[model samples]
Each structure stands twice: as C-alpha cells, then as structure tokens.
Target: MPATADFKFTASIDDSLSGSSCWSAPSNIALVKYWGKKENQIPANPSISFTLNQCKTITGIDFQPKKNTGQFSFDFLFEGQPKESFHPKIESFFQRIFPYCPYLSHFHFSIDSQNTFPHSSGIASSASGMAALSVNLMDLERQSNPSMSEEYFWQKASFLARLGSGSACRSLKGQVVVWGEHATIQGSTDLYGVEFPDEIHSNFNHYQDTILLVDKGEKQVSSTVGHDLMHNHPYATRRFEQAHDNLKAMQNVLTTGDLEQFIQLTESEALTLHAMMMTSMPYFILMKPNTLEIINKIWSFRRETKIPLCFTLDAGANVHVLYPENDKAAVLQFIQSELVGYCQKEQYICDEIGNGALKIQR
Candidate 1:
C-alpha cells in the first residue's frame, strides 16, 4: 500500500509553464458494489467493476502561469456553457487534491467537460468526469517532472481521482478494476484502484451493458447521503463482509466462465445494494414502479429464453442490463419489445466493456 506522502509533489515547476490536455474516461458499473465509505474517501468494503465504453466524460484543461493567490483559480464549463451550479463540487475536488498536486494554485485554468450520455439521464458522471480531470492535471504535472514512470503516472492519477470521488479511481484503467483492500486481491488498497491482476477468461470479453434510463430527474437522495446513512445501518457489518466474499466468488466466476454464478452474484449484489438503502435509518427507495417492471420483464425473458442476462442498479432507478456479447441480438430484441416502454421516454444507451481511459491527441 502506498502512503499519502508518496504522492506529494516535491518537484519544482517552471514559472512560465503553460499547456493544455484532454482526456476521455469511461464510467464503470460496480459488480460487487461499494455502498459505504470511511474517512478520507476510503471504501468500507472492496468492490470490482466493469469499465464501460460509450458512457464517458471528456474533459479538457488549459492552464497558464499566474500570480500565486494561495487559492485554486479556474472556470468550469459543462457542454460549452457556464454551469455555476457545478462549481462547488469542482472546487471541493480541487481543494481535496491540492495536497498531492500543490502547483494547482500557481496557474489559472479553464476547464470544460462534457458527457457522452445525456445530462441528468440517471447515469452518474462523477466516475468518468473526475477520472478525466485527474488525468488532465497529471498531464500538466508530467511537464514539471518528465521522468515520471508510466506505472506511477496511472497510480497517482487513480489516487487523485479517488480524492475527488471514490469510484473515480476505478475509471483509470483496465476492462475490470478492483478498488479498496481485500485479502484475495494482491496489491489492492483503499488509497487507489488497481487493475485486476489475474487473467480474465475470453468468455467475459466484450461483455454488454445496456443502460435503461428509468428516471431522468435528480436523485431524491444523493450517493454521498446514501453512503453516509450506512454509518448506523443495521446490516452494515454483514454487508461489508458479504462484499468481500462476493468479490472472491466473482474472481472465480470470471476465470471459470460460470455465467450462472455470475448472474446470481451480479443480481444479488444489485438488490442488496438497494436493500441497504431501503433498510437505512431514514428509509428510501430509488427504484420506481417502472424499475421493478423492467426487472420482472428481464426475469421472465431469461426464464423463457434461457439466456444469461442480468441487471444491476447504481443508486438510482436506472437499470444496467448485462449480458454476454454473443447474446446481444436476442437480449436487445427482448429489451426493445418489453423493457423499452418502462424507461423514461424510452431512453437507453448501448455500451460494452472497454479497455480504459484515453488521452486525446490534439
């Protein structure tokens, strides 16, 4: 495990430094689910996820030297328009990561970001958005310390992204990533996410994830609030323990190509995540009537067709339908005929497993 001090930037920056970088990072769907957290953005339990392809955020940063104001100086834009509402979150992120990237105060930055998926479409943009911003900041840091190793670059990027948003760390690399400490996963830590070290069977390659947008409206309870509720949650301890065991089981399922076990574990994890939400001190339900309708349709389709398809939710009413690449044709057909009606305005996104974030060359 890497200590916090290891990430502190000790290198000198040239006063005349000015540059720009753009990065595109994908949103990931957690398989084991990270529902709770500890201090300093540490996960209460380890979780693994599939990096997505189409659902991503692209962020570009242009920075130039400025008088030292002892404060972060930046303007933020969303999809080419000023979004003052987003400023607080970005400001908080900059403050949290300033310790690791101390030169932030030395430059005035113009940051613009856009998501591929529709805004407020029930997809959480934090994972990809923060990952893109972190990598872009690292790109600037590389100019100050050109000798930085490739491994260190990604590790620090993941680390900084975690400070912004815990799940953002996992968006840095790999088709599958593991975040938080677990006995079964070597090199895993709460400080940052690590790529799955073991070889993944070809059976899991090019896996499909079709996101059905059930509610596009703002979440009644934000993920931060939901995570905080777990502080006094009745089943918090057992849920954490179950996450560890499920992660271990998922490792075997991925390696041995056990689709049956995969479906069971994946679906179970999703329901258990919502179960925690429903059973919390201040009980809440993120799932809508349509959310349950879509889920039932999937169950019936799978039972009749004998397809290895399953669903997962991410703290919202939206459902991510997962299936093998080979079963896409039939599964999508079922979605069109049955599940699409349940979505808000019949909105959905077709995405697949992706390698990871990319640096866009200008």
Candidate 2:
C-alpha cells in the first residue's frame, strides 16, 4: 500500500525511523471539536489539538521474545512507580487489533514514560503518552516494514492508543491534530480516526488554545463515562446538534481569524457541553460549587477589568483561559488569585496552544 500523507517521508524507513533509542512526544490541547468516538475510539468529528511546550512524556520501548503466551510480557515504569493499568491495557489494545500486527503475540515490550508535570492533573497527560506510544510503535513497524505510509502507520498507532485511552488518538499528530470520521469515528469496523479534509484543515492551525488548571483536582466525569452519558441522555441529539453548531461557528471564525467570534463560540461550546451533562435524564454534573464560582469570577473579572480574557474547560473542572498573546501575563495573574480564593487543593497552570505529535530522537 502507498504511504498516506503524514507517513510519506520521500524515502524508505531506513536508519532514520529505525532503532529503539529513547523517544518522546509532547502533550496536546484541543482547539476545535472531538466529543464522540466509534469502534477503535476515533473521534466523531475532525478536531484539532495543539502540542505543548511544557509537559511531555519520554518513553523507551524495547521489543523482545518472551517466555509467555502470545500476550506481551510487559514491564512498565514511569513517574517512579509501576503503572498497574499499563500492562493490562496494552494487552487489551493488542487483542483488539491483532490483525494489523500479529507479531505482538510474540514480542514483549518494556515501556517507560514520565511526564514533565504532574500526572492526571487535568494537563492532558494522556495526550502525550498516547502520541508517544503511537509514534514509537509505528517507528518499530517501519523498522520491520519500511514501505508503510506515515499516515497509515500513525492511524494504526492511533488505533492502538485509543484502546488505552480515547483522547490518546489526538496526540498522534503534531502541532495540530485532526481526528476525523474514520471507522473508529464513523461507526465502522476499522480503527483509528480519519484525518480531516484538506479544505477544512487549510486554515485550522492559526487558532491557539491556552489551558488553565482552575481546580487541578480529580475529574467527576471522565472522558469514557462522560461519553457514555452523552449516549444515554434523552436529549442526546439536541445536545450533539448544539455541539455541531458550536463547532461550525468556531471553525468559521478560525478560518476568518476573527478573535471575538472565536471566543464567543468556544465559551458557548464549553458551557453547552456542561449543560448537556447537567440535563441528562438521570442527572449528572461535572462542575462543583467552586467550578461555577470560578467561572462566574472569570466573567465578573472580565467585565470589571474589561480585559479580553475568556475561559473554557474540558472534561475536568480546571479552566483553560483563552486570550491573545498580549494578554497572557494578565490572565495568568487572574488565575493565580482565583485559585487562592476559590479552590481548596488546586494550583494555577498555564500553557499556550501547542503542536501535534513529535519524535524526540535519542
């Protein structure tokens, strides 16, 4: 098969993409949309995410023939502890995609990854881990089969990452990643997300995302359960349509470079996502009193200071503040005060919009 867009490097996977030296990939923050997924956990729509400068994961994978069953003999160590879920999840990921790389049955993979920042602190650490694993495995496959396209290799790697965590798929692409409607996303048999169309992606990278860890505590609605709630909700379609509309509006503004329109639409989308969570028939909510208070404070502060600041949140209560480059310092100060007043066990974190997956070679 011919190489896909990203996989094609104008040359075969020779000494460059080969070898098991130390490898790493960066964290990502979402810009557009990626609220749903299908089979291999691909996104329902083409969403974009920025690779971050601050947080990253360094991983080293060494493949070996084990003395065990077809299942990989796994050893995982990161953050100075053994990640208990790593082994089982990796096995499960292999079980689901056995057709693509049946050799997984014979090889044992020793993997280690650690973040430059706190783990599971609403910093999108999964994004970095997933992207790193995807690229590392793909590079391995390329060492064996030099004819693969970068796109196909990434897609396959993404499929595997999805089995570990859904958001990991977004981490496979660098600078900005677009998780589109492939089988995993569009309810088909194939895995990994489809890339966005050229027409839609042409102007996508200009928009930026800056995250603020408002609460930094744990999350109430994890991505997996949160997605399930969306499915079970009686007004699912209505909310989905609302998200769709919001995504479209945001995309239009992104293409036009309209900052005002972008902020308004993104703020609305963040609220709408939470609103959907609130109104689910049985009723579930991810926000706490502090969450709401922080939001209100942000709005109040913006109103009082007349600053061009706007805040948005992902699955967790941590708020991501979005503003132009000129206002970054002021926004950071605002977040610091809000944390001092509202949150009990939270730290103020700020990161500008980042790029997609990257291979940090040894």
Candidate 3:
C-alpha cells in the first residue's frame, strides 16, 4: 500500500504554468461488486471488474495560474453546456484531493466532460468520469515534475481517482482491474485499483457485455446513500467475507476458462449485491420488475441452448448480459428476440472488454 504522504506535492510550481489535457476513460462492470466503504472512499471488500469499451466518459481540463490561491476554482461543463448541478460533486472531489494535489488552489480550471451513457444511471459513469478527470489532473502535475515515471503516473492517477469515486480507480488501466486488498492477490490494496497480475486465459479474451437499459432515470437511492446503509447492515460482515471468497474463485475461473463457474459466481455476486441493498436499513430495491424478467429470460435461453451466457446488474435497472466472443452471435440474437421488449425504449449498448483509458492528443 502507498502512503498518502508519497502523493503530496512538495516542489514549488511556477505561477506561469498553463496547459490542458483530455482523456477518454472506460467504465467498468464489477463481477464481484463493491457495495460498502470505510473511510476516505476505501472499499470494505475486494472487488474485480472488466474494463468496458463503448461506455465511457471524455473529459478535458484547461488550467492556468490565478491571482487568488486561497481556494479552488473551476468552471464546469457537460456536453458543451454549463451545468451548475454538477458543481457540488466536483467541488467535493476537489476538496478531498486538495491535500495531495495542493497546487490546485493556485490555478483556475475549465473542466468539460461528456459521457457516452446516461449520467445518473447505473452504468458506472462516475467511474469513467472521475478517471478521465484524474488523468487530466495528472497531466498538469507532470508538467511540474517531468521526471515522474509512467508506472507512478498511472498509480497516482488511480489513487487520486479513487478519492473521487472508489471504482474510478479501476477505470484507469487494464482489461481487468482489482480494487481492495485480498490475501492471495499480490499488489492489491485499498488505496487504488491494480491490473490483474496473473495471466488470463485466451477463452476469456474479448468477452461480450451487452447492456440492456431497463431504466434511464436517476436512481431513487444514490450509491453514496446505499453505501452508508451498509454501515449498520446486519449482513455486512458476511457479505465482505463472501466477496473475498468469490474474488478468489473468480481468479481461478479466469485462468482455467471455466465458464460455468464464471457464470455462477458472476450471477450470484450480482444478486448478492442487491440482496445487501434490500436487506439494509430502510431497504430499497434498485432492480425493477423488468430487470428480473431479463435475468429469467437469459437463464432460460442459456439452459435450453447450453450457451455460456449470463447476466449482472450495477445498482440500477439495466442488465449486462455477458458471454464469450465465440457466442456473441447467438447471445445477441437471443437478446434481440426475447429481451429487447422488456427494455425501456428497447435501448441497449453493445460493448466488450477494453484496454482502459486513452489520452487524446490535441
């Protein structure tokens, strides 16, 4: 684990520094969900996820020296439109990271962000958005300290991103990323996400994730509120233990290409995540009736056809249908025929495993 002191910027920065950075960071779907937090945005349990391709956020930041250095300053924009509603979250994020990136107070930032998927829906938009913003911040930091290594650059970026959104750490790099510490996984830590250190079987390469949008509206209970409920949750301890066990099991399944075990663990984790939510104090259900309907249809289709298809949810009504690249044609056809009707506006997104964030050259 990296000490927080390591991230503190101690060197004097020139007041004339002015530049910009843009990054496109992909959202991730957790096979082992992270439901709760401890302090400073640390996860209560270890979780691993697949970095997605099409579902992402593009963010750019322009920064220049400002006269006042007492407080942070930034202009926020979403899809080219000024959005004051987003200021609170960004303001909170800046406050959290200001200690580590203290140079922020000396500059005014123009932040423009846009997402490929719905903003508040359960598509992990926060993950991608924060990841992009963190990398852009890192880009500015690199201008001050050009000798920073590539390894340290991404590690610190993931660290900073986690402070913004826990899962955002995982969106920084790799097709598979693991966050939170597990005894068996080397280099895992609660501070940030790490690329899966072991070799992955070719059978798992380019895995398909077709997301079925059951609801596009904002969630009734924010993830922050849901995470807080776990503070006094009766099942929190057991759920945390279960996540560790399942993540261990998932590691083996990925290496051996055991699709059956993969399906079992993935689907179980999805349901268990919602179970935690439903069983929490003032319990709530993020899954709609159609969410369940889609799961059932996918199960039936897999049972009849013996395909390795399965489903997972992300704290919302949308369902992510997973399968191997070889079975894409069949699974997509089944999705179109049986599941599209259940989706709101028959909307869905076709995405696959990706190599994480990319820097856009100006």
Q: Report the lDDT tens digits of candidate 1 across residue range 230-264.
A: 99999999999999999999999988999999999
Q: Point to the candidate with the largest TM-score.
A: 1
Of 1 and 3, which scores higher on TM-score?
1
lDDT of all the models against the reference?
A: 0.94, 0.61, 0.92
Clashes of each: 0, 13, 0
On residues 1-362, what C-alpha lDDT tens digit does candidate 2 reach at each position? 22223332333223222236455666665555456555556555445445555667887787765555445566788866898877776667666555555555556677878887777666667667766776787777777677776666767777667666766766665454555433222322224444433233333343334454555656766777767666667776665565556555654565566766766876776777677677765557776677788778878988897776676767667666666666666766777766446654555555655555566655
Better of 2 and 3 by TM-score: 3
TM-score, one value per model: 0.99, 0.81, 0.98
For all predictions, the C-alpha RMSD in Å is 0.8, 5.1, 1.0
- Give me candidate 2's TM-score against the actual structure: 0.81
Please give, for residues 144-213, the per-residue lDDT of candidate 3 as tens digits: 9999988889989999999999999999999999999999888999988999999999988999999998
Q: Which candidate has the highest lDDT of all?
A: 1
TM-score of 1: 0.99
Q: Which stretches of model 2 miss by more than 4 angstroms?
A: 1-19, 42-46, 67-69, 182-210, 338-340, 344-346
